[model samples]
Target: MTIITRFAPSPNGSLHLGHALSAIVAHDRAKADGGRFLLRIEDIDGGRSRPELAAEFRADLAWLGLEWEEVRAQSTRIAHYDAAAEELKAQGLLYPCDCTRAQILAADPVIGPEGPIYPGTCREKHIDPHNCDGPVAWRLDVAQANRKTGPLIWEDELAGPQTARPEMLGDVVLLRKDPDTPASYHLAATLDDAADGINMVTRGMDLFSATHVHRLLQALLGLPVPRWHHHSLLLDEQGRKLAKRRHSPSLADRRLAGEDGRALAAALRAGQLPTGISCSK
Candidate 1:
């Protein structure tokens, strides 16, 4: 079967070296295998998503000499996500959660792979499975969902095959409090990959644990599964993970400062860090 990969980036910030590495890796993998590469803007956060930054992302990719067969944005796929959420609710796998982050933290939550896990405060609350009232997030009841699907398994191109333990991440929010767009990254990404026919999902290793939850969502939602390749993240001189919030130098900034984007892309592919960048240890 032909391999299909994507470079999905949130347009909330500029592309840093880490983002460049992911994009190049996915693009090269698809080209080397004579497959397809796609560009997806994950602008699900209605408040933070900047539509203007999308053009900058395309420009940066082009500067690096990377090409994709198709481009898509999550903002346009709300209906698919809504339908998937409804399907999960119909299965009694999802329920409305009124707990806020502060409340979860205040409950002395256990720290999971994805920060403080929700204590399931709203699990017992009367949640309208069909139509929830008030501003509330929709969380996937991992325990209940697992009971229906039984044991599940997914493969990582690098980490090898493994059994899925979605409960490790606890009950994750599949749909947020947004009235118009309720899908979270977990729900949207799982459905989007299936919708786009992506056979190989390439992303940062920081999200490796998220695959556990994604696997469960795929099984519960009846979507096609795809192999994952979680690559290393880029780091700064201080050996800290590159984050847009920390003001890591963006590809556009470097390019504007006379850096050769193609040369930088080559260095990244060869496992070499550019001037001041390092690999996460």
Candidate 2:
């Protein structure tokens, strides 16, 4: 099978160095394997997603000396996500949740890899999907889902084999409360990968734990499984991960400053990061 990889980035902010590393890794990996590279705009957050930012993302990638066989925007695929949610709901694997972040924290939820694992407040209520009144998030009945799937396993290029443990995330939201935008990250990403024929899911290590949940979703949805490459994350001098919210320097900034993008891409390939940036395994 031809190796296919994608760099899926949310267009809520500018593309920073961390984003650069991830895009380069995915792009070069496809090239080295004689495969195809794709670019996906994860603009599902209607409230925060900006069309201008998506256009900027494309220019940033081109400036980084990267090319893609195709591009996918999540905004165009809401119907598919709703269909998947309906299927899961039919199987009794999804439940309505109205709990807010503060409520979950008040319960003193166990802190998981993603922080503050949901306390299953609504899961205990057994809210009837049909009776759910106004704006309520749909959550996966992870414990039940796990029981249905039995033991599951997925492989990471770096971490080898991993057992599926969706419970660690508790009952994660599959659909948000907002009717205009319902699909959650876990649901959309899994469906998108399968739809795009992505056989190699190359991304940063930060999402390594998410693969477990994705594996379970694939089993439940009867989607084809893909191998993953969880590469190292780019961090700042203080060892914190580079983030757009933190005002990390962006690729667009570098481009406007007359820096050679190809040279920077070459340097990144050689593990030569910009000043105060380091890689964490």
Candidate 3:
């Protein structure tokens, strides 16, 4: 099978060095294997997603001397996600949740790989959608879902084999209560990868734990499994991950300053990061 990889980024902010490294890694890996590289705009967060940034992302990739076989925008695929949610709901793999962040925290939730794991406060409530005054989130019933699938495993290029442990995430939201953002990241990403025929999932190691839930979702949905390459994350001098919210320097800024994007891309390939930026080993 032809190796297929993608660099999926949310268009909520400018593309920073960390984002560039991820895109470059995925792009180079595909080219090295004579495979297809794709670009995906993860703009599902309707409230936070900036549609204009999608175009900027395209320009950034092109400026870096990278090419993609195709591009997919999550905004155009809401119906597909809705269909998947309906299927899971029908199989009793999902339940409605109305708990807010504060409420979950008040319950003394334990911290898992992704942060505070949902305590399943509303899991057994069987919330009636019609009776509810507002939208309700739909969370996966991971324990029950696991019972159906039994033991499962997935491979990471760096970490080798991993046992599927969806419970660590503890009833993750598949569909958010927010009307503007219907599907959660876990649900949309899994479906999108399968839909796009992505066989090699390339992303930062920060999401390595989330792969457990993705593996479970694939099993439940009967989607093809793909090998993952969880590459090192780019960090600042303080060892914190570079983030847009932190005002990390952006690729667009450098490009506008007359910096050569191709040269920067080449340097990144050689593990030569910009000042104060280092890759997490």
Candidate 4:
């Protein structure tokens, strides 16, 4: 099988140090194996997705010495997501969720990397009556999902030989059922990976919870599941993971302060990957 890797990023902001490392890993690995590196602008957030931001992403990537053979921005694939949803609904794998965010949040913690793990309140009903009125979200029926618990197994480039379960993930959203909107990140990314033949996915350890949903989607779609690697996150002095919110000083801003390519590249070299894994930055 040909090795294909992708560097997918949402263009809500400029590329940061963490993002730079992820792209370098994807591009270098593909180049090393004589494969292809793909660029995916995960600009599904219609409100936040902007043409200028997209262009800046490309420029920053070029500056970092990372490049791709092809680029695909998710905003243009709304119809594709709709088509994928139809397939899931036909397979009895999807359901309309009338549960508003407020109602779902009222129940208890949803334990997630970002929020409480969903309690799956509408599992039995299959329809959230409280807001069955309109403006629903599409969800995958995890209660009746193929197995009781998914100890999903896959080889990781960074965090190698791992297993994950649903209780740690909960039922994820597939489509934002408004019909006026598009699919969520989990939904769009799995389909894109399959469509682009991206058999390798590399991202931060912060997104480890998302891989379970991605694998389940692959199984449901009969698509080849990609090898996943959740690399360790670069942290700030406080030891908190770097992010746009907490880590205000981005590489973009730092570059504008006269930081050159060599200096920036050196800092990226010091960034860590999941324990036991190392790569030339």
Candidate 5:
């Protein structure tokens, strides 16, 4: 089968050094493997997702010399995500979670296969998570999903190997539960990957647990399981991760100050080089 990868970044903030690394890694991974790469705008939260921001992200990626088979914007496909969430709900593999964040914290559940795992606090509430009018967070049926999903173990081409126990991956929130949008990261991500025919996923090691949750979602949704590679993150000189919120030296700022895309790409590569990437640092 042909390999396909995605470089999906939320447009909540500017794409910085970390994003450059991920985009280069993802784009080059597919190109090197004789595969296809896709650029996806993971702007699920319309409340935070902005057209200008998405435009900037695309421009930044292009500036860095990253390319894709096709570019997709998540906000444009809410209807499809809505349909998939309905299907999952009908499968009884998803449930409505009425418990508030504070309530869940009061419960202080164990950290499951996924980080900050949330057990089904309202599992018995039987409340309809989707009111169809407003927004609320929705969660997947983890315990029920476990029955269908087995030991979740996979090898990371970059980060070695890893596993996420079903018991460890507690029920994950599917929608923001009456969220302003239809699906959450976990839901939209899975649906988008399957619909786009992505067969391989390359991203930062920070999302390793998320890949596990995505694995469970794939099982529950019956989507194809793709090979995953979690590459190391690019760190700032302070040893902290480069992020959009830093505001100190945003990629946009650097670029505006004459740090062209090539220069920015070189700077990121100089920090943490990905294997097989022939860049002028």
Candidate 6:
């Protein structure tokens, strides 16, 4: 199969250095293999997503001399996500979850790879597909879903072969209360990869655990599987992962300051740390 990869970024904030690393890696990998690279705007978060930032993201990639064969936005594909969610719900593999972050934190559940594992407070609550009282998020029944899919495995280019362990993350929220974007990152991304014919997924190592759950989703939804390459994440001077919440230095800022975006991309490709930036282990 022809190698295909994508650099998906949320337009909630400016494109930071960490974002550049991921984009450059994915872009170059596709070019090196003479394959297709796609740019996807993960702007499904209704409140956080800034549509204007999507244009800035495109400019940033162009400044870095990276080009993509196609571009798409998650906000444009709500029906596909709803269709997938409906399929899982029909099979009784999903339940309406009204749990809030504060409530889950207060419950003091086991700290898993992705922070506090959801306590499954609303696991038993069933919502009528035709009539729903109020807004509620959709959570996957991992245990039930797993029983049907049986043992599962997916290969990561960097981490090698791995068994599916979706249970570690607990019942993940696949859909949210946002009517405009009912799909969560887990559900949308898994489906998008298959829909885009992405045979290989290149992303940060931080999302490694997510692949396990995604594998299960693919199996349950009958989506095509893709190999993964979870690369190291860019870290700050404090050894913490670079995050948009922290206002990490953005590519736009650097570009405005007359920095050479191509040079920076080359340095990242060569594994050379730029100034205080470090690769997370």
Backbone clash count, each prediction separately: 0, 0, 0, 5, 14, 0
Best lDDT among the predictions, by candidate number? 3
Q: At residue 164, what lDDT does model 5 achieve?
A: 54
How high is the CA lDDT of each candidate model?
0.88, 0.90, 0.92, 0.72, 0.72, 0.90
lDDT of 5 by residue, 152-233 (tens): 7666776667775545557777777544666777788888988888887887776777787788777777788778888877
List TM-score per model, in order: 0.95, 0.97, 0.98, 0.86, 0.85, 0.96
Total clashes for model 3: 0
lDDT of 6 by residue, 212-279 (tens): 99999999988999999999999999998999999998899999899999998888888898889889
lDDT of 6: 0.90
Write model 4 residue lDDT over 1-281, tens digit each, in one string: 67799988776677777777778777777878888999888877766666687777777776776768656688788889888889888988777767777777788764577576667766557675355667767778865564633455666776677665544567777888554348888889889988899887878787887887777777777777789867666665556666665544555675667667555665566653334334422
lDDT score of model 4? 0.72
What lDDT is reached at residue 275 by model 5? Answer: 36
Better of 3 and 6 by lDDT: 3
Among all candidates shown, the one with the greatest TM-score:
3
Off by over 4 Å in 2: 128-133
How much is the lDDT of residue 218 in candidate 4? 73
As a whole number from 0 to 100, the lDDT of residue 248 in candidate 1 is 87
* Tens digits of per-residue lDDT for model 3, 36-122: 999899988878999899889988999999999666689999999999999999999999888889999999999998999998898
The candidate with the higher TM-score, 1 or 2, is: 2
Model 1 regions lying over 4 Å from their true place: 128-133
Error of 3 at 119 (Å): 0.8
Residue 21 lDDT (model 2): 89
